[model samples]
Target chain A: MKPLLSVRGLSKRFGTRVACRDVDFDLWPGEVLGIVGESGSGKTTLLNCLAGRLTPETGSVTYNSAAYGTVDVHDLSEARRRLLSRTEWGFVNQDAREGLRMGVSAGANIGERLMAVGARHYGDIRRTASDWLDRVEIERGRLDDRPTTYSGGMRQRLQIARNLVSEPRLVFMDEPTGGLDVSVQARILDLLRSLVGSLHLSAVLVTHDLGVARLLTHRLMVMQGGAVVEDGLTDQVLDDPQHAYTQMLVASILPV
Target chain B: MMDTISSSSSGPKEHDGPVLKVAGLTKSFIVHAHGDLALPVLRNVALAVSPGECLALVGPSGAGKSTLLRSLYGNYRADAGSIRVHHDHAWAELVGAEPRTVLDVRRRTMGFVSQFLRVIPRVATVDVVAEPLLRLGADPAEARDRAEFLLALLNIPQHLWQLPPATFSGGEQQRVNIARSLIVDYPILLLDEPTASLDAGNRDRVVELIGQRRDAGSALVGIFHDVGVRELLANRVFEVSP
Candidate 1:
């Protein structure tokens, strides 16, 4: 079967700087793909291209999705692209603030997405938001408080719940664990692993942490400069790195 | 009664205690416009920061994280609590400090970065970054020099420094927000979701900058949603529960 998401020779540039070059990949359902790289390695640039945040300089992103089948994401009309962003695709940022409106309460943040996709009944939206907050391990009483009051870990989880509440087919996470503590990072990783597996949702995670990549990704892609230097099963890449950069990265990580 | 703050910017003396202290803090709004007697937003929340420590606060959404941070900086008045800050290097209560003292503490000793970048709609980025310094009585030339240095350190594009941050990307706006915070040599820094709109790389950069600030002897209280960020940046962590 064709993969759910297919990218063919995708490329993006910011004036003289090439953010991504000739990127090609296939993301299947029920799999987490990790993209790891240093700053300016273009890992995030690729994710944005796939998420429809940035238009590609070349090539195409084809989505064989359950709701909208076999269409070029880049070629979709603005309205269709918005529909894709709203209903089928969920993009989680490294910063929870970006993922939510700080002015609104936690319930509203989760419900806004639902409302965007034609969920009008106020009671239903509130109920769904409450359910998601509970699912993400947030207490019920604080649903009316703005996100600014939540801690970093809680905010990130809230962002995750907000995106997942709509049951998006695929979610994009950018450094979801980049700024957390060891204990908190572990819990979040465990939560993400379980959620991704149990829900059978696909994810594209961008991170510089090998531990995070290992915990969540089935396949790992090592990006250098502006291109994918290596791609293989996560265990294979970590256990026996092929590329020099990947080897260096694996060596830098503490052995379990 | 909440502690009272002194009204001057004299150099430090030995009798002063921790820069900020809050105990048994609680706050709520009536929400008269929406409904009468709405629920309280914060309850029995207690936390503190010394002269040079970055305390990271962690909680799920609606846990009163921002309220806790804002109340400390004197933005929101606590309904039933006390916040004592030894401003002016002398012992004093910060709760309901005089306007001059409040302004003094905010201008010279406290720097706040909100989640949204609310730069003057038409102001130049350089001017925005230097505003805090100017308000603190730094010479215009010195303020401009400091702003330029900080912006360069944060890797903000030179040409864009003069352009309104409204035109910048989320990541760029966040950088400017950070620069604005540091423009004044405030002893304490309050950041509410400082990296909320950035990508992996930009988020890391923002974290790095905050780490540097903490190292340079600035006390920090930051509210963040990303666990990775909190772990990397904070030496101490506090979890808030409803």
Candidate 2:
């Protein structure tokens, strides 16, 4: 099958600092690919480039959009890119505040995505928002409250609801379980796992945590410095890492 | 107290038939705005959960799945029924148990994970997760250490542990709520949509954690909408009708 997303010769740089170099990959429909690396290893840069958040200095990201067919994400017009971002794609930030509108009511934050997709009826939007809240495990009673009043976990859940409310086919998640408590991360991981399966979402998950990759991802790409050092099936790579860097990464995980 | 009927000396062994038993459990709500209209949420519900068993409640919305779970946890009082929980070597009736008995049961025998996390403003995330152990008279350091472990397992960053959960995200708060409940190994566990907000990775961890608890002999009553998790943990399913 033709991949849902294709990245070729992807590279990015900031002045003299090279962020990503010669990264190449293909993500199939309904496949979850994890980009794992240490800090400043270009995983985030590569993700940003693919998600169209950062314009790569070289290479191309071609997405097979349901609405627009196959198109280059970086070459699209600004208006069309915005539309794609709001409709076919979702980006979940590590920090909830970075992704969520703190001043808006939780209901509005979720409804806004639906509205962007041309859903205009107030009752329908409100009902959808309420349903999303329930899915994210937020109390429907807190629908009218601003996210600023929410706890960190609540805000993250709200963020997930807001992003997934429109049912985007492809999502970009950066350390989705990054900063929460252990038990909290477990619950969120469980929810994410279910959502991914039910939604059939193809995702690019960027994380430093190997455990996160092992549980959520089907394929893995280990990055060191600014390039892909190893890439293969998640279990195979984690179980028997071929690259020295991948070996080090796997060995570094503290045994539970 | 009826609880004294089966003191440790005379009570059934730990591997006895069922740790929890419910018979003819029924509940209804009166809506004054509708001229005292009676809304029957649950009726004639009967269930028995043995040690190491997980009984999942599955049904359509408003089918009273959550109501049944809450009733088991004594959050909602049943109008007519008996909720017999095997604790302190005896079966205590939860339906009309004294307030003190209910509180005592909650503290020592039951652990509930509600759908929404009730955040206590200004309480550090670590302390919030640790409070359950602390209440059980565990060493303060040990309690905090356990709290930290669960928090880390759930992916809560170490830096955020000292900060209050008030500023945390919804998922973050729910994690804390889960951590708090799981910290104490109560004999009976009641969970309401426990993995509803979690992501794919964390969800698997929760399934394993719940599996461990069930394997360790905790009788679990849960409303599991996630079929994957329900299948993984539930030994029997009780379907609630709308």
Candidate 3:
């Protein structure tokens, strides 16, 4: 199948520091690609490039969609990019707080996306927001509460709801499970597994945890110093460490 | 699960002396811009967070999480259902409470970390952190001392402690938000998504601090949507039903 997203020769720099250099990748529909690396390895930098949060100095991001047809994501009109971000692209941050407006009610947070896409009926927006809240397992009663009043775990869950409420075709999750506890992490992993299967959406997950990649990814990419060192099937690369860096990473994960 | 921790920090749960409580809470608004009609935002809902228990509320966008949080804080008055709180040796609803009573609840009992970190625009970090303490009538020297200690605990460099938090990074601003919420020693602490803009390292530090607050005897309720964050703090998770 033709890929949903394709990136070629992408590069980004901050002053003299190179964040991403000549990065290349492709994402197919319903595929989960895990990007793993140490701090400053450019995993997040690459995500920024993909999401258009950072404009790369060079390269192209092509999006081939059934509804919108093929277009270079990097070269789209500003209006088109806004539409894509508001309606088609979902970005989940490592910190849920970054993704949510803590000042608003949960209902408003979820409904805001629908409203952005021209959902004007109050009843419809509330019902839709309520439905998503239930999907994420929050109480309907708490929908009016400001996000600031919620706990850390609750905020994270709220962030997921905020992103997923829009029903994007592709989602980018940066270190989705980095700060969670074991049981909560397991539950979230299970939730992601089910959500992707049911929604039939593609995901680009960035993390340092091999366990997270092992649970949710179809493919894996190892990054170091702003470049990809290896890319392969998750099992293949995880089971038979070909590169020395990959071997160290595989060895570093605590045995479950 | 309850008895393994320290004793000096232990206190009664929020239910025993709930600063905020609601039963059959419901709210709605007239959408003048959206085809004339009253749209219900929250259906009949009821919940209470006990003191010292970090109750997590998770849901998709538009799930009314913020509405519910605001209702408890007396920001949005519910259309129906009674919100009652035990305040000043009496139980009363914060909605329409006397001004002094509302002020007292805000100052002496509950600390809210708003989504926007509303810090003084041009004040030093120590003063910003110490503001809550100063508001509660602490001596300036004592407040500054407490603020300095908290800044260190948050790993903010001593040099930055005397400077304006406005000049800090996103992560640094978030730490100040945490310190500001914690300085007052309020019995109940309400935090909206506290670590949204943080990088991985700073994110972990914030999570650890939330855990520390739970250990410090303050009843906490927060809205979070990150799976990792929910995993770390939610002793009980409530998912809004479809």
Candidate 4:
């Protein structure tokens, strides 16, 4: 089977400081691959490069696009990439406020995706928005409520519904569960797991939290100094971490 | 039934041939921060289990018993050699296999009953147990029915079926874990101390369930801490040393 996303020799640097260096991997369908490291490890840079938000210094980011068969994301025109971002892929940002429109009603936030795919009927759009709200565990009555009125967790859930409402096959998640309290994080993690399974999503998740990585990812790549130090199955990487850097990262995890 | 010892160059070969085989499998962890020192755990291990048979792994702590099990399940990558399982009528090489292939094999042919249940917050116990069937495209109602059947057989009361397993007692959680794995009658099963937390009655029920799987020709490998459980379920015993 062809990989949904293939990244090879991807490197990004800000002047002399390297962010990503010679990173390569293929993300197959229905798999969640996580990139983990401390703050400067360049995990987010790698994700941005994959998402076409950051242009890399060298190498290819090829996506087996559902609409545009096997295209290099960086080579595509700006309009084409934006088209893919909405129709073929979903990007869930770490900050809910950034991902969502605070001024629009929660219903409009979700209906916009369906509308992007040429959803034309008024009743159909509203009905789908209402259904997605329920799927993400938001109150149906809050369809007209702007995101500003929602709590942090509700906004995060609303952001997820908006992204997933379009039924994109691959999702790029940057710390989807981060910055939330432990209890809220657990709820979001649970929702994310179910959504990934039911939708058969292939995701590239970037996070500094190993616990979130363990719960959501099938495979893990550990980075240090902007280079991949280890890559393997999540449990193996966590339970029998092969690299010294991975071991230190695992050890530094505060015991729950 | 107790004569098999397979660490030697030539392992015990089942008459029908082993359903699972491992040869020259080695796994080590390198401490790159500690001047690149390597901590070797599983070293050149070889074993095989046949259909309708249960092989018990007996070893002291830090002897890589659990490591070997996880490696066979493709949780850990072996440095050298192959761990192959006969699945869907062919030997699928697990070591260094693609992640997707490993996942497919796990979904259809092999089952691992970890020590505890990984509760998904608000998911009901029955849905948790019925999940494998759901993934296989079973009807939701039919899947729930089978889940309820297994839950009852494992002595999990009906009322508890609607509740999540997170707050359940240790024994109950383990039973749910076992039921969830057994939902599909996987061709090969890797068990890690599955009955450790159960009381005598529940232990007997679990022993009986595992016995039924073996009787139906599911090759099994496990770590059995209880001597009686070992005697009742193991067709042979394989010993590992650190």
Off by over 4 Å in 1: B1-242
Per-residue CA lDDT of model 3 for B110-172, tens digit only, reads 777765664443457888888777766677787787787777777788999878776688778
Chain A vs. native, model 4, TM-score: 0.98
Candidate 2 residue spans exceeding 4 A from truth = B1-242
Give candidate 4 regions above 4 Å deviation. B1-16, B31-39
Cα shift from native, residue B177, model 2 (Å): 28
Per residue, candidate 4 scores C-alpha lDDT tens digits across B1-242 of 21111111111223377889999999886776779887799888999888899999999988989989999998877899889988777789998887777878888888999888877777899999998878876778877877888888889999999998989999999999999998886878899999999999999888888887787678999999999999999989999889
Please give, for residues B1-242, the per-residue lDDT of candidate 1 as tens digits. 21122212332223333677777788875443344445587787777777557898888888878878877776665677777766666545666454335555776677898877764445579988887766556677877877887777677989888887878877788889888886665677888999898888778777877776676566788887888998887888888775
TM-score for chain A of every candidate model?
0.95, 0.98, 0.95, 0.98
Q: Where is model 3 chain B poorest over a 10-residue stretch in terms of lDDT?
A: B1-10
Per-residue lDDT of B215 in model 4: 71
iRMSD, all candidates: 28.9, 27.1, 28.6, 2.2
lDDT tens readout by residue for model 1, A1-256: 6788899999999999999999998887766899998999999999999988899989999998676679998888999888888788888898989988999999999998898778999999999999888888899887999999999999999999888888888999999977888777766786787578557788899999987887778778899999999876675567546567876787788754
List fnat per candidate, in order: 0.00, 0.00, 0.00, 0.48
Q: Any idea what lDDT model 3 has?
A: 0.75
Listed in order, the DockQ scores are 0.01, 0.01, 0.01, 0.46
Q: What DockQ score does model 2 reach against the true complex?
A: 0.01
List the candidate 3 regions with Cα displacement exceeding 4 Å: B1-242
Please report, as a residue range, the 10-residue window in candidate 1 chain A with the lowest summed lDDT.
A233-242
TM-score of each: 0.51, 0.53, 0.51, 0.94
